[model samples]
Target: MGKKQRRMEVFDARARYYPSAKLTLEELSYWIAFSRVMGIGPVRFQLLLDHFQEDVASAWHAPSYELTRIGLDQRTVDSFISQRANIDPAHELKRLDRLRIQVITWKDACYPPLLRKIDYAPPVLYACGQLTEDDLHYSIGIVGTRKMSSYGRQVTEHFTKELVKGKITIVSGLALGVDTVAHNTALDNGGRTIAVLACGLDTIYPPSNYHLAKHIVDSGQGVLLSSFPLGIKPEAGNFPARNHIISGLSLGILVTEAPPKSGALITANSALVQGREVYAVPSSIFSNSGAGVNKLIRDGAHPVTEVSDILEHLNIHTVPLPDTSVLREPENEEERLVLALLSREPRHIDDLIRDTELAPNIVTSTLTILELDGLVKQVGSMQYVRCT
Candidate 1:
């Protein structure tokens, strides 16, 4: 049998196993399947949804004449009609479930509200890790060339560290160079980060960043996100599409360094088109890699000399102040108990555990949090004291 006929057989088989007649998952499967169709992209997908009263399953079965009448070109309609038979929504759902990936449709409550506001918002998001309320904070995008200069590297790290410290969630493409620096810096500083990928969640592109991707997932402080279907390869063309999601997720895009006509410049332009703020770091006028930054500054992109430049431009106040005076309050009974046990004079862990009648692990964990908050200090092995 030909590929087209084989697809038809698969679809017929999958239809028998479609989960009941419910409108949620079954409906979602149609959307996922439609996204996998060769010629249907964001705009056409929306057209299909609207033409079918938001019922993607019904839209999937819509006749080619109806699809063309609803605005898809004849070629696109023909492609969808043929490919719809080949796609198996059930198999897609099963694969995603087995891999533990979460598919967030536009209708899902946890979909990033800021990203949904864009005109070209993705209808679905494929995430390898969790998305939480904390991720919705004022987010920033950091982009630059894969080949970065020393100056570019320093600026990316400095600004990303400060932004993460201020509780701003960092968003990036998970590409090499500036994006890698941004995500790693955020994780290192105990801040949230989100990486938008140009490929599918099941495959990590650049191959070398598998460990980095794993760290993002395991950290629980960040997520790896994509709109591509399972097993999609990272093609050169996919990146421009990826750029839109990066800019859409962020409140602003920062171009740390780029030469003229770079992909980072494309993201900055997309941010402007999306009405998000764009910031660029100024570099030496003589540097070829700095050319894009200079032009962006000339064209009215905010020139960032410090992290405060971004804060001031965004009108964000109440940044988390890190100091001895600003230590966080004890979060639970265990933390309070640990703090109560500490004195100006160092006390051994064994003494605290015995005096408070707390378990060793609890005491150790509490002391670690207290030390991180700067409310306590370790003067020696297993010996801790309250910091004045």
Candidate 2:
């Protein structure tokens, strides 16, 4: 079948399984806006839908106590109904459409089936990029601690680049530490990455990653997504709500480094609950950052010592994906530093940080780009061996 046909088939299947909306832009805008209401998680919201029976707008319009019966806490039901009138409050859909971001509802064919299967799937996703046929098949989630170690940072960067080289959609939360490294590494390597946010796409949470978030939207090749709407600041609770979507969209999640009780651990937990495989980069028992991963491994999560570990676990033959490291030409001083230290020989990242005088993430990122271009090969956990 043609790619479009295949994508449509996927969506059509979802439409069959999910509650139908008006399917109008206005209806979609309503769901998009309502998703922003604080305290309305996917499960509670789905319970309300059961009471209303596929009529989100009608259910949204129902009395506050009506939702309380369906599981929305009294306070949230009040807030949600109060917020319903503005569901498309800012004409954001027009702006989104103008910018080429596609909006996919739970009923849409393009929504990830794994994500849709989650108990509290967003009523509609305000997507900033297209989910093509190939996307349906080759999606992976790479996430972990925001304060990642140099080792965690490098493995996350390397494996994501390898996946991107294979034309996979890299999914992440766009948080500062590892998510930023993962998204940025994917981009630098000429690979597209999706950033799932805890807040609305209209605003960036960390603010530092704003430019990176913009880069994804501007590429028209990937998405910046959220269940929340415009004007909402990110809150702590909204974050785990955000984690589900990240794990929901992928075949599995890779925990590069996560301390006990870390948010990345929350994502890993979500992956487990969602029936997706979870992988961890085993860290030294001495480091606090590695504690969660060690615990996860002890609890039976697979350990990812190499890229092949993930690829093999997913059963994807990684040999065919295009090499983008060549197509991704580096610019200016940063590029110069990276190119200078990178050689065909296998080099540990510590030696590169010393030799190139670059931050570990930067050197790791640069090597990722070169590797994606088919220019470097990572031979060991710490080594970057240039491909040519």
Best by TM-score: 1
Q: Any runs in candidate 2 off by more than 4 Å, and if so which? A: 1-22, 36-57, 60-102, 317-388
lDDT by residue (tens digit), candidate 2, 1-388? 1111100001111111123354765566556655666666567666766787766668656876666776667777667766665555347656554445456776677777778877767776765555656556677888888887666776787788787877888899988888998898888887777888776555676776767777776665566777765545577777887899889888889888889978888888999999999998888889998899999999989987666677777888754554433444466676667666766445788988898777889887877777777666676677875543
Tens digit of per-residue lDDT, candidate 1, span 286-346: 9889898899999999998888888887888866633224557788999888888777556
Candidate 1 Cα outliers beyond 4 Å, as residue runs: 1-23, 321-388
**Residue 104 error, candidate 1, Å:** 0.7
Q: Give candidate 2's TM-score.
A: 0.71
When superposed on Cα atoms, how far off is each prediction in RMSD?
A: 12.0, 9.9
Give the distance in Å from residue 22's predicted Cα in candidate 1 to where it truly belongs. Answer: 10
lDDT, candidate 1, at 197: 88
Best by lDDT: 1
